[model samples]
Target: MNAFQTAAERLIQADASHTPCEPLRDLIGEADQIAAYRVQEMVTQARLDAGRRIVGRKIGLTSRAVQAQLGVGSPDHGALLDDMAYADREPIPLSRFLQPRVEAEVAFVLDRDLDVEMANVADVIRATAFVLPAIEVVDSRITDWDIRVTDTIADNASGGAFVLGTTPRALSEVDLPAIGMAIETADQVVSTGAGVACLGSPVAAVVWLARALATQETPLRAGDVILSGALGPVVPVTTPGSFCARLSGLGQVSAVFTQGEDA
Candidate 1:
C-alpha cells in the first residue's frame, strides 16, 4: 500500500478499536497539507464503502485559541457521517472514544445546495435553513494529542460526534457575530465565548467551508448540518458527566457521557 493508504488504514483501525495510536507523522515523516487531505479522503471513502452515509461537514480550528495552539492560520474541514450524530441529551459512552473533548458551536442546517467557487457570507446566510446550538465531541487518534496540522487533517480533523439543540432559529432572527455561548459541566460554567470566535462570524466559517469544499468538487447539500467550529476552548472528557452549552438566542444542547459500556 502507498504511505497515505497505509496511514489511513492505521487510523481506521485505531478508531475502530477506540485506541490511541502513534502519530502517523512518526511512521511516514510529515505529510504536507495536500497529502494529509488525501489520506482523509481515503479513510472517509473506506467508511462510505462500508455503508456509512455522509450527513454533513465540520469546520475545525476556526477559533483563534485553537489556531494558535495548532500553529495554523486557516481552518480544516472533515466529513460528518450519519452515525456520528447523537440526539440532544443523549448519553454518550466515554469508552467509545480514544481521547474525547467537547466544545460549543453553532450549527447551520442548509436549505439549498451551495457549490459556488467564491461563496460569501450572504450566500451562506441565504442557504441556511436555520441555526441551532450544538456541542461537538472531538477526539484524536494521535497519541497524547501530539499532532501537527497535517496529523489532525488526516485524522478527520479530530471529528467525533455532535449533538444539536431542539430549538432552531432562522438566520435573520439572530445576530450571527454577537451571539454569546456559555458551557457548563456539573452546574459550573467551564467556558464562555461569542460567535466572533469562529472566524469573525460563524456564518463566515460556513462560507469558507462551502468555497473550500467546492474546490474539491463537493457541494454542501440541502439538509446538511454544518458545524461552524468551536466558539470557546474545548473541555476534556476525563470523567463521566453531563455537559451543556447554552447559546444566547439559539437555546441549549446537552451531552451526557457515561462510564463503563457503550451506550
Candidate 2:
C-alpha cells in the first residue's frame, strides 16, 4: 500500500525471473522506512516462491565505504538459499544474472540457533562450527543501477548468490579477525583484504545480521550459514577466466567462467 510496495509489486510482475527490469525510482519517490522494508519483504517471498530455498543469511554494509555507497549508516539483511550457494571451483552460468559481481568474505556455519538479543558477538563465535573463505556473487535487477541509496534498498539490497570454499579451520581453532583473504583473477591478484574488514571481526557482522533477522520474527536456525560481509572492495565481473579467494585458515574457493560465453 506504500509507494515502494506498489512499485515493487509492479517491478516483480515485470521481472519476477530476476532478469533486468526498469528502475522504479520515479514511482517510489523518497521511500521511508516502512516502504523500504515492504519492498524487501515482497521480494523475499517472491524469491522463495520461485524455487529459491532459504539456506541462511547475509549481512551487508559492514564496511564504512559500503555504508556510504549504499547511503545508509546501518547494515541490511537478506535470506540466502541453497540454490544461491555454490561449491568451490564450480562453474557459474553468467547468463543467469543481470549484472553480477563478487565479494570476498568469511562464512560461518552455525551449530545452534541464534535468537534475538540472546545472540551477541561472543555468542556468534561460540555457535559457529566452522569458518571458510567465500565468494558471494551479487546481482542487481534495476536498470543502470547507478541510482541513489534508497533505490538499492528497495531493490532488496542487491541480494545475490554465494559460493563457499573448503572449511579450513574450526571456529575454535583460529582467530576470525586475523583471517586474511586474497581475491585473484587469471590476470593477477585483483584485491587483498582481511577478516577484520567485517567490522572489527566477522562475529560483529553476524551479531548484527542475526538481530536484524530477529526483528522479522525469524530466528536464525541451527546449521544455517551466515556470510559476515565483504572483506574487500567488490570486484566487477568483466572477463571471467577464473576467480578464487583464500582465507587465512580457510583453504580456498573458486569459480571458473569459460570463454565465448557471457560472463
Candidate 3:
C-alpha cells in the first residue's frame, strides 16, 4: 500500500478499536502537507463508505495558543460529520472518545453558497444566517495528543464532535472581534478568551475557511454549520462533567459528558 493509504488504515484501526495510535507524521513525513491531506481524504472517504454523512466543516488551530501547542504556523480544516453533533443538554458518552479535549468557539450557519474564488469577511457576513456559541469536543487518535502540523491535518484536524447553543444571534447584534468567552467545568472557570483570539475574529476565520474550501472545489453551502475554531485554550475532558461556555452576546452552550454506564 502507498504511504497515504497505510496512514489512513492506522487511524481507522485506532478509531475502530477505540485505541489511540502513534503519530502519522513519522510515516507521512513532518512537513508534507499535501500527503497529509491526502491521508485525511482517505480516512474521510472510509467514514462516508460506512454511511456517515458530512454536515459541515470545522476550522482548527485558529487560536494562537492552539497553533503554538500543535507547532503549526497556519490553520487547518476538517469535515464535520452528522454523527459528530450533539444536542444541547445531551449526554455525551465518554467511551466515544480517547483523550478528548474541549474548546469554546463561535459557530456560523450559512444562508447562501460561498462559491467565489476567494471569500472575504464581507462574503462571510453576507452568507451567514446566524451565529451561536459552540463547544468543540476535539479528540486525537494519535496517542498522547502528540501531533505535528501534518499529523493533525491527516487526522481530520483532530475533529471529534461539537455542541452548539440554541440562541442564535445575527452578525449585526454582536461584535465578532470583541465578544468575551468563558468556559466552566465543575463550577470553576477553566478557560477564558475573546473573539479576537480566534484568528483576529471569528468572521475572519470563516472567511479563511470559505476561501480555502472554494479553492478545494468544495464551497460552503446554505445550512452548513461552520465551527470557527477555538476562542480559548482547550480543556481536557478527563472526568465526567458538564462544560458550559458562555459567549458574550452569543449566549451559552454546554457539553455534558457521561460515563458509559450512564448512557
Give the Cα-based TM-score of candidate 2 against the true structure: 0.89
Model 2 segments beyond 4 Å from truth? 10-19, 29-31, 258-263
Error of 2 at 117 (Å): 2.5
* Candidate number of the best TM-score: 3
Error of 1 at 195 (Å): 0.6
Q: Mind giving the per-residue lDDT tens digits that candidate 2 earns over 129-168?
A: 8887889887777775665555566666676678888775
Candidate 3 residues lying further than 4 Å off, grouped into runs, are 69-71, 261-263
Q: What ordering of candidates by TM-score runs from best to worst?
A: 3, 1, 2
lDDT of each: 0.91, 0.76, 0.91
- Model 3 TM-score (2 dp): 0.97
> Per-residue lDDT for 255 in model 1?
91
lDDT, candidate 1, 19-46, per-residue tens: 7888888645663888899899999999
Worst 10 residues of 1 by lDDT: 24-33
